[model samples]
Target: MEMIVSFILAIVSYMLIDNVVLSRFYGICSFIGVGNKVKSAFSMGLAVTFVIMMATLVCYPLYFYVLVPAGIPFLDTLVYILVIASLVQIVGLFIKKTSPSLYKTLGIYLPLITTNCAVLGVVQTNSDSQLDFLTSLANGLGTSIGFLVVIVLFACMRERLNGYNIPKAMKGVPIALIVAALMAMAFMGFGGMVG
Candidate 1:
């Protein structure tokens, strides 16, 4: 029961705050580059979250049952990366064939997800935390939600800033970075809850 509660809280916390791109500054490449519109940004966020949760689902059992017990924990990084990469590829291909529209929308970014640090971060956290399968699932879902929230928020901000006059030095990536940093500080408020 306690575990279940923790899992739920973790998920909610992750969704409402502590997003990867916003909170941890991971996946900034996609967060800043791809997040120009609410729709596309939301899609990218959902895609990233989907990948992270699915990858965690596959990686955890492999780590707990196979890698760790075999005295090859050092191999965990390699194995997790390989598993995630393969799973992302398989999923991307499946989506491309099954849904042409989705394929068109997400196709370009799908490959980029394979190497995103945010995805790897989720797996690493799960392994290190020793969370049970269900908790890990909850954590992954929560983390993904967090990612989505941040991406969408950033996209909205970018959209709002489209017409703003900005100084040459403070334009583009620099302003985006500042916004992201401020967002991270905002998310820190939630960190106290989990702590």
Candidate 2:
């Protein structure tokens, strides 16, 4: 029972209170760049989620079993980056072959996942926190879900805002930035619940 409760709390905390994009501010580039359209945002979110999960699965073991024993912990960041980059390449090829339309829609943003801090952040967090495999998996999933949730919601809002007659000065990226800030503030409310 305690384990189950802990797992649930971990999910809630990562998914809501400590969201990667909204709370930690990781992956903001794609969050804002591709977020103007809901379909594209959703695709980017899934691609990010897939990379995070797969990278975590690979990275966690490599860090503990290989790096730690070798006394080369300093290489973790470099190694993690390589792992994520390779995974993204594989996923990109799969997406390209299976759904060329999504590949086109994602475009550069899909490749941008290679450098997305959020992916690195997840791997680094797992190593730093020293979480067991199950907890680390939970964290990865929750973080990706959080990313998906926020980007999709933001895209919907942007779609509506496009129809509104706003001030000339507050158009485009300016308004998007303001909305992102407001959303960040709103997500702050979840902090207390998790804490």
Candidate 3:
């Protein structure tokens, strides 16, 4: 019962209160860069989510069952990065094969997922904290979904911002950053709910 409750709490907390983008500020690169178009943002989100989840699936077991026992846990960061890079390549190939337009739209960002700190952070946090397998899985899934939600919403907001008459100084990245700060605050308000 306690484990189930912890799982549910982990999902909700990470998805909202402990958001990877807004609160943790891990994947701001894609959040601002690809968040201009709704379609592209959604695509990026899905891509990121896939990479994070897959990385978690492989990383958790590999770390606990393999790395720790091998007495070389210090190599975790390098190992995780390599794993993420491989997953990003797979996703890039799949996306390119199925949707060339999206592949082109995502362009460098597609491959950049390998460097996305959010993916690396979640995987590292799971291992560093020594969470059980199920809890670690929950944390990874929740954080990825949080990334998806925030990116899509930011994209939607940016799409609508075009209709508004904005000051010259507050245009482009400036306004986006302001909006993200506001979002971070709103998401942070939920933090006390979980803890």
Q: Specify the highest-lDDT model's number.
A: 2
* lDDT (C-alpha) at residue 163 in model 2: 81
Evaluate model 2: give its TM-score.
0.91
**What are the runs in model 3 whose C-alpha is more than 4 Å off?**
97-108
State residue 114's C-alpha deviation in candidate 2, in Å. Answer: 0.5
Q: What is the C-alpha local distance difference test score of each model? A: 0.82, 0.88, 0.88
Ranked by lDDT from best down, the candidates are 2, 3, 1
Q: Can you write out model 1's per-residue Cα lDDT over 1-195, one digit (the tens) per residue? A: 987788888787666656666666678788888856898888788789889978987898899999888988778888888988998899898998899999887888898898788899889888887878887887789878877878888888888888999888999889988888887788777766765
How many Å off is the CA of 35 in candidate 2? 3.4
Which regions of candidate 2 are displaced past 4 Å?
Answer: 98-108
Which is better, 1 or 3, measured by lDDT? Answer: 3
Write down the TM-score for model 3.
0.90
Would you estimate the TM-scores of all the predictions?
A: 0.92, 0.91, 0.90
User: Candidate 2, residue 75: CA error in Å?
Assistant: 0.3
Model 3 lDDT tens row, 1-195 = 998898999899888988999888898887888857888787788878888899999999999999999999999999999988988888788888898877776666777788788999999999999989888889888998999999999998888899899999999999999999988888878878987
Task: Return the lDDT, model 3, position 193.
Answer: 93
